[model samples]
Target chain A: MRLERRASVPPILYVAAPLAAVMVALAISGALIALAGASVPEAYRRMAIGAFGSRLAITETLTRATPLILTGLAAAVAFRARLWNIGAEGQFYIAALATAALGGAASAGGLLPGPLLIPFLMICGAAVGAMLLLAPLALRLRFGVDEVVVTLLLNFVVLLFVSMMIDGPLRDRMAFGWPQSVRVSPEAALPKLWQGTRLHVGLLVAVAMSVVVWIIQSRTAFGLEAKAAGFNPRAAAFAGVPIPKVLVGVACLSGGLAGLAGAIEVMGVKGYVTTDLSPGFGYAGIVVAMLAALNPIGVVAASLFVAATFVGVDGMSRALKVPSFIADVTVALSLLCVLVALTLVTYRIRR
Target chain B: MSETLDILASASLWAAVLRIATPLLFGVLGALLCERSGVLNLGIEGIMTFGAMIAWLTVFKTGDLWFGLAAALACGALFGLLHGGLTVVLGLSQHVAGLGVTLLGSSLSYYLYRLAIPVSGSPPTITPFQPLKIPLLSDIPLLGEALFSQTAPTYLAILLTLAVAYALAKTPLGLAIRLVGENPHAAEAQGLDPIRLRIGVVAFGSALMALGGAFLTTAAFNSFFPTMVQGRGWVCIALVVFASWMPLRALGGALLFAFFDAFQLRLQHVTGKAAPYQLFLMIPYLMSIAALVVFARRAKVPQALMQPYRRGER
Candidate 1:
């Protein structure tokens, strides 16, 4: 029997809770800054002013936030279906590799202009990612395999494969002994959104994907089916929901979006692929998705906050003598705190 | 023909393989015991790493390797306690909370390194554990030399594996641990606290994990690097799954993986083989995923795996 619990909290309060939790996280972080021997007030001001101080920083934050948004969406979608696609990091690499091939081939042929080639390459990239994801997804659906372990392990496989490519076949001949791919042709490069900034069409694509995802997640029949599957498989089965089918369906879509993020970064930000292109963006997406409580709208806001934490840390590093890893430590600590806090929103702490 | 003889005749390579396999064996066995108790300890890699880091750090400060080993064991046991507390007591999501512990341990270890090294603390090249010679067996040509000639921790790992296997299969408490894993509710109904059983198994597993890491810091790498693990934890996870939750099978799987790893290292120095190292490294990961896909259909996790049981629940 269900316990006599308090009534469910309002949606608005749930929406605002993450932000409120983030503020508390910041207060703790401020103390950390103080411990780092920096003035807390000045550090906070610098963090805010640094992220929005100029077009470049703002653009950088947006550009950084782009992948976070896609990865967040990817995570949100998969988790919504109760399929933990833990290998998004590897999927990101595979997808980026797919786009890199297109960027190289199309640019080499001089067949299409940069604007036209970019979208096609991005689509190709997404397709590669979806293809890789289908393996584990199919296994989970058809064979009842544990998606979590399969997906997580595949991440390393994909990562190593990508590293192999960069180190071997993709290694630039003219680069004088560096592990990097050939540069994408100017024709494949994304159009810059602002002058003197690395921001490009990738950020715009990320925003568009988020909006479409919101509509799909909240307004579509497929979305409802997915949620039903996650909340209670037995109930969904009783209701005749194709649980496995829906799980695979959502996994493919999630992997595709994650792949698109990888593709965009290749075509937009770093013209040539490097080993460090998407640094833990796959894993960070989990953090972002969880931080937002998997709300598409919340994802948008949460990623920016997460991004700001890093931008602020970089700012602090430059302004003060503290290392930037301090920012990473603080962010990780904040995430742990936020997770504990978020769980409380759903389940009351009895003890 | 002579090449095969050279490869086989060199006792050093076999010794190296066994040496490298020691840590992996420890990790896999540690994980094996925990899973037997129905607790999949995903934090083995991090716990192991932290144990190594702490062991090395302590050894360096105290100048006593045994004390350092004790500290490492303590560090590992604490993490196991945390995992047990969250999964068994508090009933938090095991997978996520275990992952959180990994992140926490990994991050803390790196931070401690940063605090200690200050960009200049001799990039983690500790004076690793020295080889311990088993008095009479050290005289054997190849087999005995390969197996017996190693660090104290390596010998300890082998003993622990044999002991753990026996305890889990033969002991009364082991039956209780198995009962908790297979059916925690039933075990509780039978008057055994599933939570305590889980905690015990996990703590025992974690202590072994710390020993694995200590082998690395004190004996393998001699110091901790930020990325020293480089996804070894994930490897451990794959090793367990590939073995289908069987301790004996896990031992085999882990040995195979260690063999692949050692083989890859050997090939790295051979002419025109550097590129293959990347591909070779993928073998274990690929095998694990494939095993998960291929065998997951038949394998069954403990009834209560990843599910937190509330006391006196409906």
Candidate 2:
């Protein structure tokens, strides 16, 4: 058998591919549900209901999707340029900590007025995240190092650094020796979109950012240059696209998006930083981006799918005694399946 | 200063270095073998995690440590097959596919563990491998106790290093693999199947990686826990660059890294409250980045590394 590239791909394949991938992933994970001695159909029914059943359930899923949307965009932006920023997890942690630190100090010292504090913390948080990624990117540019390994290794380093800060300088005194940072001031908390629900304005910000990113990617000159560099760096360089500057710009935007996820996550939900602040939100972002085929607008939909899977799986597991890790397995399977589906969209097998 | 010097003089410290180096020894060699054949297995982290879990589970169930190790190797080969099929046969993105494999392996391991074993205060344990003493070597001075008295897997890891180094340098098969990595067209012209060679090598290399994970549970620790593999798999990837894709140098790199790890652990104990323990934990990761900076420029990378091979395409 041989594979032949298609001259033109139908627009419908873009929509059909992810949907088909998710169906296949669910069918495969159904076996795991059966293995856990739960009825597969029943378990799936529970998952769907748990995700969308009540006002509370829908709000919780959206709240979960808020950080995922930002992180998904982070991965989408970086992966588009082929930057492979695996350190999003680390960037999330560091940015969250930075936001918390700024929020606490600003409130305690009366340093900034209430209305301005949130935006200030958000900007500072993103800057810190941007700088974190630039270190690895600089290494790649100067030394010709593969950014994949360097970015991955930095995740562990950043996590440890966060651990040290929460346990030492950032530790909350009144929390009875628990290793967590002091709470962000009320002034720094993001306003809730609906009263009596956990859903905050972060969801609105995430949805708006998705639209903004889509416009930047599809309608801007810089996006065209970035895509050109990604397609063929040698050709782009020969065309005077300035590959280094483009990569640096992509790195900042990608890192800033991830950092903003951390900042918003703290302000909107937890109100404090801990080692377990993110349940692999950074890693999940990669899967979300891939499932969306690295499209900025598609990332919002993909994040919602992932967040629902996770939130729904939690409720399903509680009801059926199935392991919650099935959510991770499902997400991972969809990523691999989507990769294959995307390949099929571009190429056909001939025997 | 004297307290720091005293750590270097202790026999136990040297022994700890070897113990810590054992898993890394397997991991670096596994990664090196795969990369030398033009396939980058970024799935090492998840592969190792699965290996650690499956081996411990096997031992816990059957009460046979060797069987547990065998189970881990078998499961690892299966994961490798999945990874190899994706990258080699399907011609997918190596980066994304490997990450998918990692996610699948780790989460599946956790799911299986939770399914098989009920949640409790602490995870179950098994009788791990005890250190074996080489008769006369164990009687010698500091070097004897540190080097000669180690678990069976530690010795196997060292011997495997020599075997890999020799096979790569002297064997025709190794030459074919290297040729495939450098220029598959040349290998194809010479009547070798680059596709099969890459798939086979990735599978075998991944088995070694699983054994490295097995070592963590069966020797380094007696119990299995989530995330225990930590970032050791990633550190091994860096060591591959540090070694410049040579087996003997890979061995040296693993030892050097483990020495830093062992020393920092000791330093943590010596300093007590003077510094935070997390800072010491950060040393190995920071050191890997520093090593990459130092050697990445000078290293000769495999020409076809990370490039997917199509039967007829250049």
* Top candidate by lDDT: 2
lDDT of 1 by residue, B1-314 (tens): 45444655667767787777787777887787788777777777678778878888898778888898899888899999978876666565566666667766776676565655557746746576788889889988887788778888778777776776677788898788778888878998999987777887898788888787888888877667776766666677666666766666776776677766665555555535536667877876776677666767677576666666667674
| Model 1 fnat value | 0.45
Scored by Cα lDDT, where does model 2 land? 0.92
What is the per-residue lDDT of model 2 for residues B75-124, given as tens digits with 9 covering 90 to 100? 88999899998898888888999999999989999999999998999888
Error of 2 at A142 (Å): 0.6
lDDT of 2 at A136: 95
Q: Assess each prediction's global lDDT (C-alpha) against the native.
A: 0.76, 0.92
**Steric clash pairs (candidate 2):** none
Worst 10 residues of 2 chain A by lDDT: A171-180
> How good is the docking of model 1, as DockQ?
0.46
DockQ for every model, please: 0.46, 0.87
